[model samples]
Target chain A: MKKLKRSARLVEMTQYLLSRPHTLIPLTTFADRYGAAKSSISEDLVIIKEVFEDEGMGELQTHAGAAGGVKFIPKMPKDQALIFAEELCRQLQQKDRVLPGGYLYMSDLLGQPSLMNEAGKIFATAFADQEIDVVMTVETKGIPLAYATGAQLNLPVVLVRRDHQVTEGSAVSINYVSGSHKSIHTMSLSRRALKEKSKVLIVDDFMKAGGTIQGMVDLLAEFDAEVAGVGVLVESGEVESEERLLRDYVSLATLAGVDSKSKEINVKPGNYFSK
Target chain B: MKKLKRSARLVEMTQYLLSRPHTLIPLTTFADRYGAAKSSISEDLVIIKEVFEDEGMGELQTHAGAAGGVKFIPKMPKDQALIFAEELCRQLQQKDRVLPGGYLYMSDLLGQPSLMNEAGKIFATAFADQEIDVVMTVETKGIPLAYATGAQLNLPVVLVRRDHQVTEGSAVSINYVSGSHKSIHTMSLSRRALKEKSKVLIVDDFMKAGGTIQGMVDLLAEFDAEVAGVGVLVESGEVESEERLLRDYVSLATLAGVDSKSKEINVKPGNYFSK
Candidate 1:
């Protein structure tokens, strides 16, 4: 790369940092890339850092010392996140989304990359402080949300398959009762998918009676992995407190009620916004 | 938002453009956000555009006129994309990834956000010129890759479920023969999931006899949609040329052969690299 002017360097540096979130890059890397001095790189970073903070894009953490550099920690400010969550609640409340069995159709919302990306940013923000080694989610609908969070957190995503497949190699399978339907289902994970004793962050598109999430929690025990955190895009608020299989999770929206006959749906911002 | 310094504005402008790819943003939006003149915003975009192109980040397309703005079209240099494809081929060639029945375990590579993002860039670059409205793929394995491609192309992703779900409402299902297994399997998509006559870009993780890709193409026909393009991460080289179900698709890597007894997996860059 040839030497670039400060303006070009700033734009490139901002892009480099944005693309590689949660990874530390040495100042010298930028210095070398631009054919500039360390002091000049530092000055450029200071300007970038201020804009990031001021705009609430995220935090640029700089470490001092011979081996130190900077890391970009992506974050969504609480106020902005609240607004986005409220907007999601409104979207989820559409009457047509109600299904025959009181189920709400959310596949359309989950299919939107920009929407999922925003939700991922919120989940990433919610769990930024946790020591999460990987983002875990079930197969099917949850995959997109899981990947979204993983992208923002710069962590690899591990998917739990609903049925065992030969292509997965050796795997651990477990049976758990679905809380909503009271039906037994099997979920499995490849042995090589997750490391032993890894601090895992569980994510899902929706949680009903918390059975699937609890099933995942139980499955994690087989791998000697710890549940660092759990986050969901939506949670069913109709589940009785005692009937819910798990507690202590973050949700962006809560499905309060669904009247299939009347085609009425009620949704509100999830517990993410504490009143 | 208050007015920012020129350096700060440039940094903010770059971040904004990178985050919203392929979407046109009027210069007035930036001008208002930074409380700057349109002339100043134009100058800032010039710097960002030059850096984006020079660094192979992508291209910033500017449209002039009242409704005109700028759109970020992500691209990966052909040489760099080939290098990445070669690296992926090497990773897929590992003996441990060779499972029984000649199936290669690639969940690990697909789980990586960074790697998938890079692959997404390559696929996006491959289909950037196509008239694509949405990205389509099957359930489970292909969801991540589809979403990644969707993110890069600034498009929505529609998933085809293996089994129809009640929550999906009315759906159109079709049974397609599995290319490699020679077994019939059902794949369905919700009627409401996609608009009629959409231009669709099909993406998948693997293709053998192109049965699954063909299945998606068949399903698109039901919706009166057009197949704008097709991209796969890996394609099987063992499939007889005459027996292949589909033609004219892009692949990043090719699985030349898999020796189950000796556990030798031969892999190479796919047709993406003409040479």
Candidate 2:
């Protein structure tokens, strides 16, 4: 690589850090790549740190000594997260999104990368302090959200399948009754998908009676994995307290109520704000 | 944003452009954003553009005249893409990945966000010139890849489910024969997921006999959508030419052959390099 001027170097360095989040890069690596002095690299980092904070683009943590360097931690500011949640609620409140059984048509929102990225950042920020080994989610809808959050945290995403696929080799399948309909459903996970005793964060697109989440929690026990946290895009606010399958979970939006007869729906920011 | 200095402004602008790929932003927008003159914003973009090109982080396309700004087109250089494909092949060639019926265990690779991001960038670059409105993929495995590609292209992703769910409302389901086994399989897409005559880019995790890809193409016909392109992460080389259902597509890696008895597998870079 040719030696670049300070301006060019800054732009490259910023992109590099943004692309590889949660990974430490020593100062010597950058110094050698740019053929710049260690002191100059330090000064450049300081500028990046200030701008990163000013723009709310997470923190650029710096470590001193020979073995230490810098790491980028993606985070969403509380106020910004609230704004996003509010916006999501507004989108969710649309009457057309309400299905026959009170299900929201959120596939459009989940499909948008920009929106998913924001949600991912919020989840990453919420679990930033936790020791999470991997992000877990059920097959289908939650895959994108899980991947986005995993990208932000620089962690691998492990998917739990609805049905056992032959390609996955050996697997563990468990049946649990759905909290909403009291129907039995089976969820499976590849033996290779997760390691025993790993700390996992569960994410999902929607939570109706919290049955699906509970199933995941129970399934994790088979792998001897610990559930570090659970995050959902939307949760059913009408679920009775006693019927709720899970108690501790984070939600971005709440489906307060819906009037199928009048085609009216109500949504509010989830417990994320209160937390 | 507060009036940041030139250095800070550059950092902020870089991050902003990177996040919103393929979206046009006028110079005045940036000028107003930073409370700086258009001339200054133009200068900042020049630095960003230079670094973006030099670092192979895609192109910063600038449009002149009123109502014109810049668009970030995510791309992967040919050399870098080859290197990525080679790495993927090495990973796929592991004997342990070979399952009964010649399926490869690639969930671990697909679960890694960094790897998916790279594959996404490569697909984005390959189809950058195409006028694509949305990215389409099947449920479960292909969702992440589709989402990553959609993120790069700044487009929405539409997932075609194997089984219809009540939450999806009215859906269109079609049965297609598996090209390899001639077995019938069902795929469903929500009526609301796609628009009529929309240009779609189909992406998938793996392709064998191209049966699934063909199914998606046929399913798009129901929506009156056009298949602009098809991209797959891995394609089976063992599929005889006479059995191939589709030929026009791009693949990142090729599963050349697998010897289940000896626990030996062969993999190579896909058609992407040849093209």
Which stretches of candidate 1 lie above 4 Å from their native place?
A: none
Query: What TM-score did chain B of candidate 2 earn?
Result: 0.98
Tens digits of per-residue lDDT for model 2 on A1-275?
46988888888889989998999999998999999998988988899999888778899999888889999998889998999999999988888887877667888888898799899999999999899999999988888899999999999999999999998989999998899899999999999999999999999998988999999999999999999999999898999999998989999999888888787888899998897
Q: What C-alpha lDDT, on a 0 to 100 scale, does residue A82 get in candidate 1?
A: 90
With a 3 Å backbone cut-off (N, CA, C), the pairs that clash in candidate 1 are none
lDDT of 1 at B111: 96
TM-score for chain B of all predictions: 0.98, 0.98
DockQ of 1: 0.89
Clashing residue pairs in candidate 2 are none
Specify the poorest-scoring 10-residue window by lDDT in model 2 chain B. B1-10
Instruction: List RMSD in Å for every model shown.
Output: 1.0, 0.9
True contacts kept of each: 0.88, 0.84
TM-score of 2: 0.99
**Which candidate has the highest DockQ of all?**
1
TM-score, each model? 0.99, 0.99
